[model samples]
Target: MYDHYDALIFDMDGTLVDSGQLHEFGWSETLNKYGIPIDRPLMRSLAGVPTKATIEILLQKFNLTPTATLDEMNDFKEAWVHDNMHNFVKPTALIEVAKKYHGIKPMAIGTGAYTQEAITILGLCGLDKYIDAVVGADQVKNPKPAPDTFLRCAELLGAAPEKCVVFEDSKLGLQAAASAGMAGIDVLLVHAIENDYFL
Candidate 1:
């Protein structure tokens, strides 16, 4: 299915790894400690946004000024996620696609998570070896929906933006792929189809 693309780019959280719940737990725990309530819909809406960016959005959504700075909240949430991810992070079926093209085609991960955090999670899922490069939100000036992350991945892979295909689970990610002039595969719909087929 991906034969035509010169390279493949994947989003980490919901696309390559089943780490959404882990992220949600991290945010929930962090917010609770700060006396803020968790808003699942808002969290899910900002799936492909960077950690600090998401926290900023959440604070605005809740309309509560926090004692902690955005960086502090981001650090606390990321720390919790890193500490607990090993027990919860798992690879989704789409990992088979990455496994299939491991060396045949250049592959990169472009994620909203910090670069090192993405690496650690991929390692825990045994997917780090399959990827040639990783571009995190921290590495780019703008996160998903800006195309910077995927474009950087394409550049690092020596592939043109139009020659790359991105596998993503979030609307922002898909938009980013489009903005990068890359084809996008909606892994959520793909997973749903796969599940139905298996059933």
Candidate 2:
């Protein structure tokens, strides 16, 4: 299902890396410390949103005003996650894919994560230099499900949106790529599809 596209746009957390659960745990711990409870269904809806946008969603969903800046909360989450990454599993294919795609086609990362966080995690996994371009939450005005991040990523990669294909696990990320008129490869459904590959 993914072979037709020229470039592969990857979502960092749950798609290419096995760190979404860790992120959720970290976010829960950090927010709970601030007395910000995590609402399951609501949090899921914010999956592909920017950090600030996620905070806004949480605040409204939880019916509480933020006690701190979105940046501060995000910093807390990133710190907690990085501090606990040893407990998280890195994607086995990260380095191999980079090596295989060295000259195959350009690869870019479009994520709701902060650029610094994305770079740090990729660096920790030794997958940093393999990427040709990156579009992070900090780089776009709107996040996933809005097409801004993917559109910006396509722009940075010098690829047309329609020609780009995105690899994602979240429904929001898939919708974002589709909304941008791009093909989406749902890594979560890889096992059931002949053309899909598990990461």
Candidate 3:
């Protein structure tokens, strides 16, 4: 039913994988270790943002000078996720949609996750084989809602942004898709509308 779209772009975290809370927990632990306190709600709202950007924003908000390099903070966050993912991460219900279009249409992941992190999680969920391309934080100079990541995925798939539909679970991702000239489908509603398929 998504035949009109030349490509499908999926966001890795809350969209394809149930890892938002896990990521929030990771950020919390990392920040706590640094004696930085953060508003959990604010942290949750930054879901689709890259770790580096999130750290910068948090530091700015708290008026705290970064004690660690951006790379170090990013590394710490990812490591925390890596160590604890087995307990809270898994493919979300949207994998069914991804599987349905696996061979029929080109699909890619445009994520704020680090390249290796996205790769590892997709592999863990058995989704790596289905995704044709992956554009991660490491590959983009700008993160969502900047549109760079999603646009890069469309480029790698040789599809125009207007011809792709991005599945996202966060407002930042939706904004990115719109900025990329692509339609966005919220993962939360995808199931209710799964049968319709945007035909």
* TM-score per model over all chains: 0.94, 0.85, 0.91
Report how far residue 199 has shifted in candidate 1, in Å. 21
- Show model 2 residue runs off by greater than 4 Å: 1-3, 86-89, 92-99, 191-199
Q: How good is model 1 by TM-score?
A: 0.94
Residue range 55-167, candidate 1, lDDT tens digits: 77777878888888877888898899989998888888888899889899999999988999999999999999999999998899989889999999999999999999999
Better of 1 and 2 by TM-score: 1
* Candidate closer to the true structure by TM-score (higher is better), 1 or 3: 1
For every candidate, C-alpha RMSD to the true structure in Å? 3.4, 4.0, 4.7
Cα displacement (angstroms), candidate 2, residue 32, comes to: 1.0
Q: Tell me how far the alpha carbon of residue 80 in candidate 3 is from the true structure, in angstroms, after superposition.
A: 1.2
lDDT of 3 by residue, 1-199 (tens): 6888999999988788877667768887889877678786777678778887888898899999878788888788889999887777778778888889989999999998888888888888888999999899889888889989998999999998899999987888899999999999987776542211111
Best-first order by lDDT: 1, 3, 2
**Local accuracy of candidate 2 as per-residue lDDT tens digits, 1-199:** 3456677788887766667667778877877877888677666656667666777777887789778887898778778877887677476454465577766778989998888778877777666777888778888887778899988988888888898988877889989989999998777576232111121
Using lDDT as the measure, which candidate wins? 1
lDDT of 2 at 121: 78
